[model samples]
Target: MDSIPVDFQWLGGAAFAIAIAVLAAWSKVFGKKEGPPAPKVQEFYASGQLADMGPVKELVESVGLVMQQMVRTNIALEETSKGIHHLVQAYEKHLAEEQRDREIAEEVARQLKDKR
Candidate 1:
């Protein structure tokens, strides 16, 4: 009689199946619930708001443009004020020169009248 080698593959598969069934039963009895996040995770996320605001890129560009315009306007205002100040100074100098000329003419007329 020729001896055939025993195949233990079937026994191994049956044992693996039983072990998996036991684990499934244990998990159903004692494991955490399957659907939602844990309470701790939910609580941690509760303080955060989801930003559904439209288009971040456009928002940034608009804000940047506003700031740039404000800066340019400020600079223009400063330059305009400087120009006004220069004009005021020139007007004052012109007034002073006109007053001095009037005084000199008055003195010359007085001297001529005294000589006559």
Candidate 2:
């Protein structure tokens, strides 16, 4: 049987080329889409638009305050829910005790009527 000679150098080069082609195709399919870049602080200063920072700062502070208020409200709601749950349990226990007492009293009354 005649043996076919394999060239290692050609195989290595082909493998590298295929790897590069795969990477290029993958990037084209999944890379971030390009859009207009945001204006930098330097650009804003250069255009005499530095006054915009004041309103932006105020907006950030207001948002922070709102977030704090929401956190406090959530805590209050959780506490109220716990208190209501405890109250419901206590009321159920009281009702059960009253029902037992009423049943006992009715049984005693029936016994007395039978004795007469």
Candidate 3:
């Protein structure tokens, strides 16, 4: 195996260190700083105004209204589905009755032809 030159390795390491330092310095100068935000609860309490607070009650009420409407719509949909099922059942019964009546009429016609 060929041995790598030591001087080239040292020069490469130095260049890497310089690049890391430059990046660190640039980030410190221009990067956005992160910290805890101002306390909204403290601001609202200190302001001594009820209107400044978050609308927790209003949000709850709106959610309740939405749930109520959803329940009502679901019930209406279920009733409509049941009505369609009943209509289909009635139509099937009517067809059966009509078929039976036609069979009876055919039997009477055959008896009349035998008499003639």
Query: Best candidate per TM-score, number?
Result: 2
Candidate 3 per-residue C-alpha lDDT over 39-86 given as tens digits, one digit per residue, 9 for 90 to 100: 666555577876744587788899999999999999999999999999
State TM-scores per candidate.
Answer: 0.53, 0.58, 0.50
Which of 1 and 3 is the better model by TM-score? 1
The clash count for each model shown is: 0, 0, 0
lDDT of 2 by residue, 1-116 (tens): 84434667777778999999999999999986979988665677798888878998899999999999999999999999999999999999999999999999999999999999
Which sections of candidate 1 miss by over 4 Å? 1-54
Give the candidate order by descending TM-score. 2, 1, 3
> Please, what are the lDDT tens digits per residue for candidate 1 over residues 1-116?
94433687777788999999999999989886679766664442365633443466679999999999999999999999999999999999999999999999999999999999
Best of the two (1, 3) by lDDT: 3
**Best-to-worst ranking by lDDT:** 2, 3, 1
State each model's C-alpha RMSD to the native.
15.3, 9.7, 7.0
lDDT of 1 at 112: 100
TM-score-best of 2 and 3: 2
